[model samples]
Target: MRKRIALLAACGLLAIGTAAVPANAAEPVFPLVGPSALELPLPVDGSGAREQRLSITLDHPATGAPFAGLFTVDLRKVAGVATVRDHASDSSHQCTEKDGELLCAYKGLPVSLELDVAAAKGAAKGATGEITVTGKVPGATVTPLTTKVSVGGPDLVMREMKLKKDLRPGESQPMPLVFANEGTQAAKGVVLELGTTRGMELVETYDNCRTRTAGDLTTVLCSVEGDFVPGAAYELAGDSPLHIKATAHAYDDVLRYGIYPAGDEPKAAASSGKARAGRKLGVSPAKSAPAAPGLRASDLNPGDNRREFAFHTENTADFTTSPVSLKGKAGDTLSTAFVFENKGPAWIHAANPADSLARTVVVVPEGAKVTGKPQECLAVDADGTKRAEQLGAPRYECALGNRVSENEKVVYPFDLLIEKVVEDAKGSVTVGDWGTSAPRPHAFDPNAGDNTAAVVINAKGGTGTGPSPSPSTSGSPSPTPSASVSASASASPTAKASTAGTGTTAQGGNLASTGSTVGPIAVGAAALVAAGGALYVAVRRRGVRG
Candidate 1:
């Protein structure tokens, strides 16, 4: 009976074990699971904080089964934690804080949990920290999710101080003071102060500021409301002397309370104790402390901001011409050169080099006709009309183009034909006159006497010798005496004596007009006179025989 009962019990145990093996084989296997990492935006100056919402979604290989696990928020590596709130309010889950961490437990195959966190105020700028969310599955291992946070703050810097106008005694000028906020945080309730040295004054300002005068020096204090944003510039209020200094001050609330003390409230009692100690020692009490603390006033820029300028008197230009004198005879071509020079502390159109500054005019001698002139000069009628026909002594107008440098000189050559007798006849050449159509005349000529040059011409013979001179001095001389007259009048005639006197005068005139500079025109004049000699002799011999 005992053997039979033991056999039945063994069979029953075997049957139960076989049934459990199949049941265990039917269970599903799951893969890995983890939460997503996050990066939060925080200010560098520790003046501002950022809030981030994080979600941890369980990922598994099994599709049908739900996640069953426990999770915890590990904040031991995070240095600045202001607050943390659980976002599992709508779910049937409980989250409790312990040892600066949050712990939660849930039963499901695939589950998602959320958390909202904020950075602490007064956190040190550039400080880096991390928070982690770790999870555990009943049957599988899971990876932890980590997020990084950084601290930031504000930085105030002075860029430059510039003078916008020329400095002169008794004149007001604009001096711009430029400043910029370089950091990521904003600066609030900033104050700017300007102090000047003796001989400097503050006349007017665009910003609302208080001014105080001590001797010739001045002080200005101005305030700015609200916050000065990062990467923004603050320009000067108005025009002031360049000899001045500026300073900026603000309260550093973030550094004093949030970062230093590791709390949201400042240590007023500690500061109050210092004030009390001062009062007890018979010293005056200190002023009320600011809300934030780090630096009270920013260090003044490292370089010199003052500027100095020199002044000089206005400039003037003096233009002058050299003296001119010449003598010529009828039918003789005479050429003379005139020189114009500028003696100046300033050049013509010095303020603007591209403009026309002056005009030069040369009046032809009445007894002489205009024949040749410099290429830059234009022959004009007495009325100043270009290319117009004139009976005698046409005028020429020349531009002083590009001759604007100080101490510069320009030479003008004039050519003329002596048509009539001129006894010490005088002509003139003037520059910077109102008669020109040029834009602006020279400012002024210090010495007007030298601006006009005198020209003298003498035509030894009369007009009866050749055709009437053209309105222009360039008219051609009468045709050369015919070859028949030249052979017949080759012998000496009594009329030759009168002709000899005329020849002597003509030679003298040629020398006076050209001063060692003989040209083709002078040679042509000599040939014409030789031809006239032949005609004169032939006529005189005929008269003698009659």
Candidate 2:
């Protein structure tokens, strides 16, 4: 029988997001998705087999709407040399295995249903098997998804490094990208990718690598294809050691890198900026006993293939905004924008591209109905809940992207129809944290008093606020009960900024990286944030925190 399930494209293997399918609003199709394959580690010294997982998750269609309700997943198997086990002890899971078939009756969507996989005793290296999973949802079509398993394969692990210590503005530091093939077979080639956070840039321009802009980030992708022998380690020998420079605007940031078998890089639009400097990044066996070897040929264990090192340059940024006071009478339509500027010894940014940047909130004075606003701004009620009607809301919030360069000014324009201008009608403009009513202390901001600005109309007895081109030191003019904000550049109807950054790895610090312990960046208390695999938070001395 033909398997009627949808298999995620064999590349990248999720290794993860809800892949969005394009479908009609009335007839959305759900695509079943999971890793393309699994690798079980059969330790060479007879340490028994290392376990991997047969995890399955779902991807929605274009609308971003997720399906709800119960769905049944049946794992009809094709026997092989690998063993599959269920986690009965996990209180929330409702799955059972019988007659060599696994069935899970899951509620809503299968966020992730994982089954343990390992090489069976006496299984030879390279032994393989398959599992076909089909979903049953009434009136819904989910093409079946299948994942293969091998007893052993190439395992690529990255090595962490100590970045240059006491990094200062405009100073550069060398980061050696190192990894090893720790599997039974050779890896044919590997793809190395680097993402240096905001305020930093990759210094080398090589023919084998291309640089692409991601919002405020610079990502470099290098292809170094060659035979990697098992048990041998390898490092990319660029024309020079790879170095990342902290620019004059740098403060806290991270260097994110990953190693993937050459063929497995996720498909992206052929982005330009593939600068060729006539240099090929060559690979060589590590001078250590290990030789540089081989990728997914499927990594028996794909979890240890990426690393992120967070560092801070001694710097601070002062972001200030001011109240704009206006004198308008009844029925007079007024035009204005709430704005702020970065006065910097440093620039401010989210750690990664997909992370949220600072925001700007604008509330109109009493008796004024908002008639014109930015498309990026969201209309919300007093409590910050999104309003069904976008215009004429009491408050509006906008996204500022993940980065704000030095001296950059972000403004959000608004046109207010004064219904009946009242004396000293006051509004508010506050900037901080991704669109929130309350913000966590910006540990790097030195001037707290200028964070909030005021907007007022029809002055009387010194009441109309937010006017004046100067930063307010008269304390907070919390005119609006609902707090939400963000901004970018001056544009029609509103302001615009860079697109928000992207994310990698949905969960866990264990996914895909070479096993390199981090250097000076790890000296502080480490906080693991799994929204993006292995994205970590660390607080440092000298008051800089990441």
Candidate 3:
């Protein structure tokens, strides 16, 4: 019957193969037994006792008949076993002490022999040991096994420092520093060194700190008097707050020194017997012996060992706009150019292409209709209306493209049709109008007077230029206007005036001013004179007939 049950169990095991099935399917079991490897902790201070839970599992391959066996743990190499207790309900196991070793034996099938082990006093840290197991089964082959156990020691790690606030020049601020012992053992005789670059100075003093200044840099070496316990922090700010200030822009560096458990020394030294009295051994003695047991200081790990932080002073930017003036007849088209410049200790950078740090706004003069503007300019009224229908006065907000560096200037040209005669048609052009607002806010412009410039438009053929010429009523020729009557006579016309100038300025720092020149005015004035003479002759004949 037992053999029959074993055959049925084997068939069931075949039904459920090694493939992972749904949770509903029963898991397959195997006849595997072993003593697991151990990782035992040994303190660097060697004070606290450590414990490791030991167990051996015997899984039954076929589940029908219980197979009896003798399972034993032969602990000969390991020395620190204070107590062992069986966890199984079936009381068939016993532990015996034999020749400074613990031997445990159990008799069961599909059993787990669980035991609790406590390290004995003075167990060496970083030492290696092993445990062997033997299993004897009635109808199975029991293989002997050996497993290694390593003793664990302390691991030391330093925590990084973070900036709590922005560091500024001439102002002393506390920089928080912290280090931690993340290992199992305490770190002894901890030391920390904080160094500063050219412009930074240290103000506070702490215990065991020796300050030394070499050239423009300074170093403060601090020794922590107490032992840093495991999982505890040594804060530099606890005893005395560390205050550091930069005379200008500078960086600070920090390094830590502490003792941690280095792994065990070599177990054996290589050697050959020395030469004998008469015969030559032809071998040298051992070169050196193993090192003594202790902790080791921290070594530099490229990515983890060092840290740096920096601070800076304030920066200023000054933007200025030059004056713009033009002269044009009542019906003539006028193009006036304005230049905006930056005199800065710092470059105004646009965070992105669309974000501008500075903007120029040109206020359109009255009596002058805006006919043309650069593509970068968006024509809008003061009430945010595009191409304002009411047309009292319109303004064009132009973008001065990214990074207006020191001594850099941006030129804006405007095309206007002079509708009616008005003397000194004044308007305003300004840079950095909005302070820290949309488009851009020039937060650091110290001088507001230079940011704005007046646009003076002198209307030609007005009362100030000369007396008004008599209107031709009858066949009387009109007086010829002066050769200097054109606005171009005052300013030379350039190619830029004929064609709309580009949004960006030229390569050189100089800004090319667009001349106020009208091309069609000379031709239009000649036609006007001839038409007036013909109208005067016809009106004289009608008067004579009446």
Largest TM-score belongs to which candidate?
2
Write one digit per residue (lDDT tens) for candidate 1, span 4-64.
3233234231111011222345453332222222334454344545555555555556467
Which of 2 and 3 is the better model by TM-score? 2
- If scored against the real structure, what TM-score would every candidate get? 0.30, 0.55, 0.33
Model 2 lDDT tens row, 1-546 = 012113234344542323335353455556666776777778557787777756666555444443443434433343657777765454335666777777676654334456777777888876777766666554455656667777777778888877774678889967777888777877787778788767788876778887777555577778876787788888766455677899888898778887777665433512456755866778777765444434447666667887888878888887666576655455554445555456676877776767756666777778888776556567888788889887789987766666666755444445566788588788887777663574433678888787787677766765332222221122112121112222111212211121111211111111122111110111101111122111111111121110
- In model 1, the runs with Cα more than 4 Å from the true position are 1-313, 350-355, 388-393, 433-441, 459-546
Candidate 2's C-alpha runs over 4 A off are 1-39, 43-80, 84-117, 126-150, 266-275, 288-296, 322-325, 330-333, 343-345, 350-407, 413-546
Top-scoring candidate (lDDT): 2
How do all the candidates rank in terms of TM-score, highest first? Answer: 2, 3, 1
Off by over 4 Å in 3: 1-312, 350-354, 386-393, 433-441, 459-491, 495-546
Question: Which ranking of candidates, highest lDDT first?
Answer: 2, 3, 1
lDDT score for residue 40 of model 1: 40
Error of 3 at 138 (Å): 60
